[model samples]
Target: MGTKIVAVYENGVLRPKKKLNLPAGTEVELIIRPSLKGLIKLFEGVEVKKDAESALNETRERKLWE
Candidate 1:
């Protein structure tokens, strides 16, 4: 199962903003990408979450069949 979640890189670790549905000790990989603050601002007053989720879902689907 693949999913995307937000986190903060603090000190020397990445802290998730919310609880995750992963089993204990389940090793996970990290693909760090910089935050797009400017793009977000350009879409100000719009629903950013839905757009981001859609983009991620599309990418995941494409990668799954690759």
Candidate 2:
């Protein structure tokens, strides 16, 4: 298998399944099709969570994202 992507389904599974076979170190882009709930979940904590720079004390942590 070449970079197995976690398949997702809501009430019913999506069709058109395919397989991939590649050599070692073969990097590939994954086109994941997340369900509506799954897509919303990805933004759950991220959207509400405070920015690390604003939440973290300057003396307490070093932020790479800032």
Candidate 3:
């Protein structure tokens, strides 16, 4: 399982906003990515007639035989 935490980059180190459960000297991998709020705003003005759930169900039904 993987854990997700928000962190801030300071002078040089990345500081986690919350405390972690890991012990001292434990090595962990980091996957840095920006928030999606900004990306979502890019399509704010767009409109769609079909909801995601309905479209996903339609696609799944079509591929059921294959």
Candidate 4:
């Protein structure tokens, strides 16, 4: 997912954006780098969120801390 770069836009022009057959209400994350080619990368935020949520849930369930 980290390696996926969905779009590349430049100088008011947009590159070929990727196509996805996704379900509604899907959440995505974008990394925008304006200093270099206006580079942009899209990621599946759901995956990251799921991991974080599980991690937090586990800690809460066990009352553990580092």
Clashing residue pairs in candidate 4 (N, C-alpha, C atoms within 3 angstroms): none
Where does candidate 2 have its weakest 10-residue lDDT segment? 57-66
Clashing residue pairs found in predicted model 1:
none
Residue 57's C-alpha lDDT in candidate 3?
A: 71
lDDT of 2 by residue, 1-66 (tens): 455445545578633245445577876666655566665674466543567676445414643222
Listed in order, each prediction's TM-score against the native is 0.52, 0.24, 0.53, 0.29
What lDDT would candidate 1 get against the real structure? 0.72
Q: Which runs of model 3 end up more than 4 angstroms from their true locations? A: 37-66
lDDT, candidate 4, 6-66, per-residue tens: 5667799645377656678977666654333321222223243467778568646864332
Residues 1-65, candidate 1: write the lDDT tens digits.
68888888899989998999889999999887645763466456754356778966775686632
Worst 10 residues of 4 by lDDT: 35-44
Measured with C-alpha atoms, the lDDT of residue 15 in candidate 3 is 94
**Model 2 ranges with Cα > 4 A deviation:** 1-32, 48-66
In the range 1-60, model 3's lDDT, one tens digit per residue, is 899998888899999989999999999999876556643664477555699897557646
